[model samples]
Target: MMKSILFFLIFSVSAALSAQTLTLTEQQINQHLTTQLGRDFPINLGSWLKAGVRLADIQVALGRQEADKARVSGRAVVILEQGGVRRDWDISGDFSARPRFNSEEGALYLDEFELLGYRLNNQDASGQANFIMPLLLQSLAEYLAQNPVYRLDEQDPLQRQLKESVLGLSISPGQLTLQGLE
Candidate 1:
């Protein structure tokens, strides 16, 4: 009886630990990005995820490279959730030029612009998308490092809400988008 009880206790603890663990894959990340946009302005997801790609680069890749005399502008909103908590970030701006259209380009190329808006929602649900928040938070962390001061405080309202997050990117393309941070 004692042995059985001990085994059950250990098993329970292990199970609890496993339940709290979250692993995010490239596919999941892409889904998170998609859900965040959810029929909003189209985003060249492939180019947006590339490493070393900044939001500005995304603007260019989206074919917004320069502010030509003739250009198109658009806006998009992204929502992210972690541990069941959700936060929203908005992106709005204009693209200057469209690059040479290529059959292989798909939906990933545009450049030139600006993002204006603020974070919304301090909490969300613990859905499958909840696990991807860590990646978003980490990306936001890197972004904050570059520009230490913004209109908001160091513990920006958003930062306080994300205090208990633990997540990482299991896979990523060559670029990452700081959407509005740029």
Candidate 2:
């Protein structure tokens, strides 16, 4: 009887330890981004810009670079009003991104964007896009670095959720895997 009890305990512990990983699929990730893009975020460009940035289209490629990085292609339009004259600056660009994990907040933010190409009003604005599209995207790498996109808990109104969370991340082309810490 004693031997049987000991074996059962050992088996249960090992199983629990190995089953601590979490994974998110590529489709799931894109769905989340799409939902977010649909929402209009009001941005004040101060003197340089005067309008809202509308994210028209966005596509994310995971595992395109390394296991922990991603590539994104997106399009946005900035309504720039200069001297009471408004112009539609349609921009299309692609960049590489990576996630910054925060254990304290139990969230991950997509950051480190490298602008590969940018076009404004049908003109290539790689060199001048910085000054033109100031309201829309001026170095999104810096902006997203401070924003958290994924949250592991806080689903309910006021509840303390998931005690043990993902400690490490392994991102692949089609999926993101979370590994337990310790």
Candidate 3:
């Protein structure tokens, strides 16, 4: 019985050491975001002064910059109706945000988003974009904050074991690493 107990303790220590860190590639994160966030496309940005906006064609890029942030780029379609005249405009831009993990949910989310840059396809739409971009940014931030970019698979034993023990998340070029305090 003592021999069996010693063997079991050794095995447990080895398993714990092996599971100390979990790493995910950038591609994995991007694919997860695309699959999860795609369903909510063409989100309307309520009308203001007879002008309306919609967001679609969202794309995510992880570890694109040296900073520890994920980059998201997408197109915003703007519609302006004036005196029964309708026009459509396109504004495209990319933004970056720091990633955070929620231990209770076993999920990854974005925080502290910063708009990198934006441009209107039609110069005439500059005024509209100026008025609408802030709203678009806020909407995107709120949506992403609530929705996870990636969720841990509780069915997987290693992931399940690591979920609650994860002490912090780190982003390097092209990769994300989760490590436990121990």
Candidate 4:
């Protein structure tokens, strides 16, 4: 018994030591997704925008959409910058679907952004409060992979991970408009 306990203790310590930890709040995760994606997007929408993307608006829309099928109410300005000049590329309206199950209670949902018209690469929505992170991450990852800043064959580490993560998701293609920005 003593040997078994000792073995378990040592195994637990070694496992803990070998683990890499990342603790991120919802806001932080969203912000990271935005920044990482913004760095590699085909267009400099945020830089062109007068105020860039608002975290609060995205969060609220995501939360509301996840919780209930409320009208998505947020706008993203896509700014175009060339030769030191800046212009709006377009405005974006976010959309999400009201979860059938009580996602907020304990259900898990995945790729739940029906408003964008494309399904997330991951189609599992089985838990409450479970779909938003993957949706945001996958969206950013998809954008980055599809749009390369310098047209390089290889992307940055974060971009690669994001892209790989996207492949694992259950996403369907969605469309965004750039006409309104100009």
Instruction: Write model 1 residue lDDT over 1-182, tens digit each, in one string.
Output: 99999999998787556532222222332333343223322222243332221231111122133222113232334554335654454433433322221112111122221223223233443443244333443343333233211111125433222223322212123222211110
Q: Which is the leading candidate under lDDT?
A: 3
- CA lDDT, every prediction? 0.30, 0.65, 0.73, 0.32
In model 4, the runs with Cα more than 4 Å from the true position are: 1-24, 37-40, 43-63, 68-87, 97-112, 116-182
Model 2 TM-score is: 0.71
User: Ten-residue segment with the worst summed lDDT in candidate 1?
Assistant: 173-182
Encode model 4's per-residue lDDT on 80-161: one tens digit a residue: 3445755442233445533221112211122233445322222432332143333343453234234221211134443323
Write one digit per residue (lDDT tens) for candidate 3, span 68-111. Answer: 88887777676666568777777787788888999999998888
User: Which segments of model 3 are wrong by more than 4 Å?
Assistant: 1-19, 36-38, 41-56, 76-89, 122-126
Provide TM-scores for the models.
0.23, 0.71, 0.71, 0.26
lDDT preference between candidates 1 and 4, better one? 4
lDDT measured at residue 81 in model 4 versus the true structure, 0 to 100: 43
Per-residue C-alpha lDDT of model 2 across residues 61-164, encoded as one tens digit per residue: 77876667877778877666668866666777777788766767876678877676666655643544476554356534455567665666566422123324
- Model 2 spans with C-alpha error above 4 angstroms: 1-19, 121-130, 134-136, 153-164
| Candidates arranged by lDDT, highest first | 3, 2, 4, 1
| Prediction 3 TM-score vs. true | 0.71
